[model samples]
Every structure is written in C-alpha cells, then in structure tokens.
Target: MGTITALGLLLLICMVVVGGTQGLQAWISLIFNFAALFFAMVLMAFHLSPVLVTLVTGVIVLAMTIFLGGNDSNSTMVAFYASVAVLILLVILIIPIEHWAQIQGFGQEDSEDLEGMSTILGISYLNVAVSTAILSTLGAIAEAAIAIAAGLAEILEQHPKITLKNLQGAGFKVGSQIIGTTFNTLFFGFFGGFLALFIWFAGVHYSLGEILNDKILVGEVLMVLFSMMSVIATIPLTTWAMVASERQARKKFVK
Candidate 1:
C-alpha cells in the first residue's frame, strides 16, 4: 500500500480499537470532511464564485461533522444550527478584517516564488484570501459548537432534573476548558506548521520586526486570531443555543 493509504488504515485500526463504533463514525466523517475541502478547491480553481464555494463546502462539512461524527439526530440538529449561527456572525467580522489586513498579493520578496506564474489569473486574490480565512475559521467554529453541544447533551442525559442555571454554569465551565485547549492547539499548530519557514528566516538573518511585518506572516497571524475569536464566540453561542433549546422542549412537554 501507498504510505498515505497505509497510514490511513492504521488510523482506522487505532480508532476502532480505542472507540469502537464511535471511532469508525468519526473516521468516516473525517474522510467526508477532507472530500469537502477537496471539492471546494476544485470548484474554486474552475473560477467559480469563491463565496458560493465557501458556503457550499461549509454546509457539507458541517453536515458530515455533526451527523456522521456519532452524534444522534437531536445533537446533530443542535450542532448544525449553532454552527451555522456562529458562521454567519464570523463572516460578517471576517470581511472587514480581511480588507484591513491588506495582505492580498505576493510580496516583492516573494518574486522568486512567483517567477513562473502569470500576472493575470483573472481572479481577485483578496477574495481568495477572505475565502480562505472564512473556510479555516469555519472548521474551528464547527468543532467548538459540536463539542459544546455534545457535552451539554450528555449533561442533560445524566442529570435530567438539572436546573437551567446549573446547566448554563456547566456549559461555561466546559467552554472555558475548550477555549484554553483550542487556543493552544491553534497557536502551536501554526508554529509547528511553519517551523521550516522559521528556520529559513533565521538562516537568512531576517529580523524579528521584518518577519512580523511580512505580508504572508501577518496574514497567517490574522487567520489564526480570526479562528481563535470564532472559537471563543462559538462557546457562548453554543451554550445559549443548548440551554434555550432545552427550555423550549421543557415548555412544550409541559403544555
């Protein structure tokens, strides 16, 4: 088997051993998630509208993530709605921030890298940048929403009589933990992904200020911050959605 296929099979085996059916479902969802990303890229390459591609991919990925990741129908519904709500809010903020970041095109220092590329690709690089930011942030937002929704669902299952106030408190506690870990994941993930680039910069004797001011670096930092903010915002929104959903269900039952 090819290396990637071998590694994938190994992951499947490990997940099955560790989490059984849930792990298998999670693996399937992961595959679908990757497929969604690939499809988005393919569509965008064909000169399709970036915003439309983003929307389509976001919905598909969210469905696969929530529905195929071992959540029951109710939990899936909650996650889907909460994620969508957070996505809308994030998009509104991302547009203006991307415009302000001013990191659209290749930098003069990057001329060597673009030596063979045509000057006119007939597409707005700014739109692509914004689309990329939106897509990246969407994944984090979905993940946070799904995690919060699933945790809150489990809490309700375990404590059927838990008061709304107590449930909200539980959500806050869980959210705090999620935010802490998620921030670390994003921060270190960026570092790890760019370790080679950092080494190259050091080798070239680029000063810290120059590195920080570089367009690509600034753009990446902005993307990371945008994702972190989305995750942070998702926590409260997901919590509120869960609490409000439960309250509505309780009222309906009473009636």
Candidate 2:
C-alpha cells in the first residue's frame, strides 16, 4: 500500500513537472508495464506455467507500445516487435551453446538446500532453474528495446531528411557504443549481484572447469550474453525496418 501510494505520488510529480496533458502517456506506460510485471509475479507465485506467464507479459508489452504513444505508435511498435524478434533469436542461439558448455541447473551446493525440502512436492528444480535463467534476461531485453526505440526516434528527429544509407551508418556507429556499454553493464551487474556465490565457489575449492561450467553460473552468463546479443542484433534489425517503412511511405506519396 505504501509502495502504491509512493508510485502514485511519483506519477503526480511527473505530471506536474512535464506539465500540460503529457501525464497521460506516463500513466499508460506505468499501468501496462505494472500490469505485465504483476502478472508475471502472480504466475510465479502460483507455480503456474512459465511459458504462459511469459506470453502474457509479452502481450502486455505489445499493448503498451501500441496504445501509449498515440501518434508515435508506429515507431514504438516496430521497436518492440524487433526487440522481441531479437530475443527469440538469441534464445535459439544460446541453447546449443549452453548445451555444448554443459551448463544445467544450479550448483551441487544448492542441491542440499533442495534436499531439506520434501521432494514429494513435485516442484521441478530444473524447471525453476531454467525459468530463472530465462526470466533474468527479460530486464536486459526490456531496457534494450526501449533504448533502441528511443535512439531511433532521436536520430529521426535530429535528421528529419536523413538518407537511409546515412541513417544505417549512424545507427551502426551509435549501436556499437551502446552495445559495448550495455554488455559491460550486464557483466558487472551480474558479478556484483552474485559475488557471494562466486566467493562460495572459490572458498569451497571448486575446480576452474567445475565452477565455470556450473549450471547456475552458466545460466547467468548465458542470460547476460544472449541478452546483449539480442540488443545488438535488434539495433540493425530496427534500423532496417524503419528505413524500409520510410521508403515505402515515400513511394506511396510519389504514386
């Protein structure tokens, strides 16, 4: 209740600061994003299907993109769709790599934590582990999509008459820098959050291969790397989509 009240006050502040009726978009974005997030949490809490949960979350994101921006819906929708496509591709790419590296489930130490619980409850630790691996990447994916969309919009605004070739070139250049920083952020963020786990592995004298190839560790690594890849891939994919759409619009005008 307190958190909700805080968010409401924050929304009020944002509305006042932005002035005019601009607060409507913020409210829409907040409502849809929170709805999606809450849906995911409820699904997890209920031990419902992770796949279904992810799907519902995705639908909310799509709805948010489509409805929030009004006049800017086209660009927002394009970016959101492209981001999702890239995420799907990254997941497909990571599966083989994860298997090749033999990373599955959390480390053996966590197994003890599980053993203490009644095994007859039928909760699949492996499912939970894999779900954690996948869900962890969602934050990166969400951020990347927003970044790409915003970047593209800024580029278009700054150079209203920009040619496709120049647009693509600039996107590549900016995207390279963004991707580098994003990957760095992911690496350090993961390391920072899981530092204790790393210490536990080292103090317990786990071998290099054992530690590196541990399921949980590998899952986290894959989550970060693949999310990074998704972002990088979407930059180009989105740029192309924007370019193609503009060209089609011009052609229609000429006709």
Candidate 3:
C-alpha cells in the first residue's frame, strides 16, 4: 500500500513537471487502463471471447492514448494510428519468432505454484500457464508504443524544422536509448519477479542446459527482445508520421 502510494505520488509529480495538459491526459490514461483491465477480467470470468476481450481492451488502450495522451486531438489521432501500425508489425514479428523458439506455456517447474492456484480454480494448469505467458507480453507492447509516441512528439517539438531524414535519424538515436533501458528494465523485472522460480531450479540442481531450454525462460527472452525490437522499429515509423502530420498542419494554415 505504501509503495503504491509512493508510485502514485511520483507519477503525479512527473506529470505536473511535464505539463498540465499532458499530466491530465496521463491521469485519464491510467484510469482507463485500470478500467480496461477490470473489464477484461470480468469478460474472462464469464468465459467470453478471450480474443474479443483482448480486442476491446486494445481499443480502450487506443482510446486512452487519443483522449488522454497527446497535446491535441489531431496529434493524439496521429499517435493512435502510428501506434497501431507498430503493434501490428510487432505482432507479425513476435508470432513467428515465438514459434521458431518452440516456447509454449510455462516451464515444467512452475507446478508448485499451480498447486495452490489449481485448488482455488478448477481450470487446467497448462491453460493458465499459456494465458499468463501471453498476458505478460501484452504490457511490453503497450509500453513500447506509448514510449515511441512520446519520444517522437518530443523530438518534433524540439526540432520543428528538422528534415524528414534528420527526424528519422534522431528517432533512431532516441529509440536506441529507449530500447537499451527498456530491455534492461524488462530483463531485470523478469529476473526479479521470477527469482523464487530460479531458486527452485538451482535448489533442485537442474542442469544449466535444461534451465536455458525451459519454455518459460524462452518466453521471457522472446518477450523482452520482441518489445525491444518493436520499439526500435516504431521510432522511425513514428517520426515519419509526426513529420507528415506537421507538414499537413502547416499546409492547412498556409491555405
């Protein structure tokens, strides 16, 4: 509870410093994110379309970005469109890579955690494992999109006269930085979040090769790399979109 409060306050401070316009939008975005998650869980509980639930949640996410994330409605719209493009590309890339890696569901070793969960819910542990694996990756995609949009916006603001090529180069540079930190963040987050499981592996003296080949481990690695690559890809795409939008706006004013 204390940690939550600290984070809330930290977000508030960050928003205030950034700009009231953006801050208000961010707060709204956060609220909508929670609402979407709640709705998604409700849908899941009712055994409704998991795909539909995900789609609805995704729409809500896009709406949140458009309504609460950007400086203007037009900018938000552009951001939303660009974000979708990046997400689609990322999905296309992740789908094949995940298959090539031969990763599925959780590691064979998470059975202990499954015991407590299985007792509470009569669902198959393997299904739950797969669901969780997919769920974990969703946040990465969302985060990368948001970061890409925000970075492009800042770059445009700072260099309104920047040529398209230069803008793209700047985006690549900014994206590289984002990728480095985000990848490390995801990597360490996975490491810290799954420390207990790793300890279990070590305790049981699982071979290093066995641990490396584990499905769960492979999934985590893929999620991190997928997100990293997606952000890298989004950078230039977003920069181009920003340039196009700005040029159109200027043209409108000139006319």
Candidate 4:
C-alpha cells in the first residue's frame, strides 16, 4: 500500500525468488534482529546498563543472523564464535575511544531539532555512544566472519583431505577478497548517509580542519573506522576459528 511497504514486499519477493528457503529464513532473521534491537533499546531506556544490554544483544543478534543464514552448522558455529570474539574486542576498543572523543549527546546540527526539548535523559550518553558504535560494527563483523568461515567450510567440504595449512591459506584468500569491498561499502554508506551534512559544511565554507573537528562528522567517522577495524580483526580471527574447528574435528575422527 505505502511506498515502504511496496518496497519491502518487492524485496521479499525478489529474495524468495532468488534464494527460496534461505531467503525466507533471512527475512525472518531480519525481523527477529529488529525486534531484538527494539528490546535492547527498551531495556536501555529503563536504566539498564547500555554496555550489558549491547553485549547480550550482540550475542543474540549474531547467533540469529549467522545460524539462520542456512549455512551448515560447522560454518555457522565458527562464524558465531569469531563474531562474538570480534564484538567483545570492538566493545573494548569503543569504550575508551568514545570517552576520549567526547562526542556524546546532540551535536549543533541537532540543536534546532532539539529546541525546547530537555537533553537530560538520566542515562550516560557515553554509554549510549559506545553502544551505538558497537552495534554499528556488528554487521561488518558478522559479515566478514561468516564469509570467511563459510568459504573455508565449503573448501574443506570439497577437499576433505585438505591440510590445515592449505585451509588457512584459503581462508586468508577469502578474507582478502571481501575486505576491500567491505571497507568501500562502509565508506560509501557513511558518505551517502551524510551527504547533506557534507554539503552543509561546503555551503558554510568550513575549512577542512573545521569539518574534521565537527562532533557529528567525527562521530560518524569513528563508527566507520570501528567497523573497518572489526572487519580486519574478524578475518584473522575467523580464519583461526575455522582452522581450529577443523583441527578439533580431525582429532575426534582420528580418536
């Protein structure tokens, strides 16, 4: 009926036509992921620790997204594990960086929108920023992890007798292929989403230094950077995880 509804229906149709059962599962997982994020926000609004909520929600979202992706259990499991590890590492990196950056709360661009509105919401904006950063990186982290893990798993499936060394090399190759695309995806997404802000800066004739110093721009830049770091971290981690899983499986079979 509505434009968004029409677009959503079209997407669903296309996915189902192209992917069949896996597409349906992916659609369902998308809904579940939305619900999970909504629930996390509600919890955060209720004064629950944002960090804790984010950590727990991260695990749940990763499990749902990776496991429901229709990959075999081994691949999904390794992906999930590597993703969680990346999430934790990202959280650690995000907290201190967010604090040091002091980019929390509404920026000047949001002032008109926040006019006559109280900014005091009782919760720490630092935590909120940290949560936001963590959440933003999750997609990239999960994607990289699953891609590398799934690719490695498929290679192993085809070459059942593949050496751990060869499998690791294959994993690295897969990771290399995806890394550039993932970085560009994140960069363009950030730029496209904030093209208006960039135009605003240009219209105001802001210098490069001033533009870089803007709270809003810096915040977004940090998110993109965090995502890139997570992807970089996830590649090696997922590769290790897949190789470790294979090693374990082989040991059990031999025993």
Local distance difference test scores for all models? 0.84, 0.68, 0.66, 0.90
CA error at residue 174 for candidate 1, angstroms = 0.9
Model 3 collision count: 0
Q: Compared with the true structure, what per-residue lDDT tens digits does model 3 show for residues 145-177?
A: 556556767777787777767766776776777
Using all chains and alpha carbons, the TM-scores for the candidates as numbered come to 0.92, 0.75, 0.73, 0.97
**Of the pair 3 and 4, which is ahead by lDDT?**
4
Clashes within 3 Å, all models in order: 0, 0, 0, 0
Candidate with the greatest TM-score versus the true structure: 4
Instruction: Please provide, for model 1 over 1-255, each residue's C-alpha lDDT reduced to its tens digit, 9 standing for 90 to 100.
Output: 899999999999999999999999888988888888888888888999887788778877877777777356776688888888887887788889878878887776578889988888877778788888888776687788888888889999999889999998988888987888899888887778877767878899999899988888888889899889888888888888889989999999999
- Angstrom error of the Cα, residue 69, model 2: value is 8.5
lDDT (Cα, tens digit) per residue for candidate 2, span 124-191: 44444445555566556656666666676688888878887987787677677678788888889888
Candidate 2 deviant stretches above 4 angstroms: 1-38, 41-49, 62-71, 95-104, 120-130
lDDT at 126 for candidate 2? 48
- Judge candidate 1 against the unseen true structure and give its global Cα lDDT, from 0 to 1: 0.84
| Candidates sorted on lDDT, descending | 4, 1, 2, 3
Candidate 4: segments with Cα more than 4 A from true spot? none
